[model samples]
Target: AVMDFACPGLMGDLTSFRKIYAAPIGKAGERGASEEEKRIGAARRAELGRLTQGFIHARKADEINASLLPPKTEYVVFIRLTPTQEDMYIRALKQKSLQSMLGRCGKSDAEAPTSVLGVIQNLQKLCNAASLVEASDEFDIDASSKL
Candidate 1:
């Protein structure tokens, strides 16, 4: 029926189109739709399958493999955090637990993120470089776990 106004008889007259396709599909979209409603939806969907069948084919495995790009370079370097940094991370984790228990674990409009996820993110920043959170005047890359 919507097609009558939307595309003017493109799918046929609104009444017939609604009875054949739109109504069945619309009923299927609802939560807890009846078995009969679902069956009708499947039948209607099957009827329209050919219109998109060609576009639904999968890509070949060979094509997928051929499309992959090789990595340019890779290296691994490890650095240990200072004791103070580890202590700060532990304190943040404990604070995050308390905040979660109080139903105050998500970011607020005026605050830096303080949720459990946010606190974990802060810990990650600390691992990368303490300067990210502490705003140190002199950043020491050699001190970061990621460097």
Candidate 2:
């Protein structure tokens, strides 16, 4: 049998996450993947490789992040993508969510995170759509037309 494996931690959690996508192999792969599919797979794998290779300014970045963090807070971004794209994607997601949240709050000023824990919880739900917290959103379920 052809040997190949999927690399985990595509989104986050740093360790042993189940793979969402994987490449194919040999004749079966030839039958399975068109040229574009193969190119996309190669691009994805390359992105993962680039991330696993390590960041040059990681220590500085970590130090800065820690300086802003509260004591004993566990914050980790486990992205399996290129540094630039990953940063952009996260920035976009944060902007989208926080803008809505702040708009909902109706205060133009950015408040000093009164509840870091709550922020984390909300973020967890945002990241992991399968999260129990997400499933438990009564308002969202009630609001959805399909539900």
lDDT of each: 0.68, 0.48
- TM per candidate comes to 0.40, 0.21
Candidate 2 TM-score, true structure as reference: 0.21
Q: How do the residues 33-138 of candidate 2 rate in per-residue lDDT, one tens digit apiece?
A: 6887777667666665565555323357668878997767578877444343345447645776565655556454455254444666655644444233334534
Which runs in model 2 stand beyond 4 Å of their true positions?
1-30, 55-147
Q: Which of the numbered candidates is closest to the native, going by highest TM-score?
A: 1
